[model samples]
Target: MTASVVLKFPVFTVTEFRPLDRQIPKNHPSNSVKTYLPLKTPRFPRQVKARTTLMEAAQSGSSVNTSTNASMKLLFVEMGVGYDQHGQDITAAAMRACRDAISSNSIPAFRRGSIPGVTFGQMKLQIKLGVPHSLQQSLDIRRVKSVFPYGEIVKFEVVDGGMICSSGVLVEEMGDKNDDCYIVNAAVYVGY
Candidate 1:
């Protein structure tokens, strides 16, 4: 018995009908031949054009306008995740997340005059937090703001995210109201 297989593509189609139990004889002309097909046009015309444009722009050092303030150019972004296993404090988790994000980083570009016309005093930061929906009200924005030692907070947004799961054990002395553990994610965008 033999089976037929058909493959369809935007540029071409292929149909193969071969024996299931036996291979084609080695002496057959089809067994020793190969075919190469040339494409008349690109399969993804827009993608090819866009990629070339992006490469040219990048090579020319052209910056893209992303921030609302045209003067503010994004330097880098730091991300971190924190969780409160013992206590059900969302703010504590958020603070820890922020700390974790910036702890390992030391950015001296502003003070060192790495960026032309920019100074440490002009540094701006945008903080985005992910917290559970139910615990959004309990999050202390002021306390979270205090985590940053410097930088002017230009934008702050809180979206419904993060997770609440069991910590496996609840200790009354540790202020665990329940066995629920609160997790928070933080993204700090640094720009000037």
Candidate 2:
């Protein structure tokens, strides 16, 4: 005698049977039944390619040349937020944001040679900053690039983002200029 079992799921259905003492032949056609189910394909957001080159000079003290070609593969991304409560300097906020993003991360893979054929000097970085639209012209791109210690800066872009709100206090001595505070967001993409 044989015992048969059938299981059904929203995505698929399976049917099979087992004998009391003997096992069914592996190549038997009727031994099992499999039904294919229609599945919806998953959708993913599009990736942003690096377009603009922010820095061409080697500021990180490394002599290795960095390539900004489209062939590079992105490994990961780090995000952070920063704000300037005084002086109303948007560049300061942007630098803080970049520092905040990379401060907590440790990339041993590059130094340890975990990525085959990739060296620490060969690392590539792309930075995207979000600043208030009104203060875009005031952003100092060169000063902000100083925050990065290593890696080749391939792409740097500034888009309208972040926020502006009252800090509730304005002091002439503190260089407040005004009570308004400037906030900036940074996204750093790391790759080889």
Which of the numbered candidates is closest to the native, going by highest TM-score?
A: 1
Task: Please identify model 1 stretches exceeding 4 Å from their true place.
Answer: 1-71
Candidates in order: C-alpha RMSD to true structure:
7.6, 12.1
Give, for candidate 1, the lowest lDDT window spanning 10 residues.
46-55
lDDT of 1: 0.84
Candidate 1 local lDDT, residue 17: 65
lDDT of 1 by residue, 65-173 (tens): 5533456567778999989998799999999999999999998998899988888999998989999999999999999999999999988888899999999999999
Q: What is the C-alpha lDDT of each candidate?
A: 0.84, 0.84
Off by over 4 Å in 2: 1-69
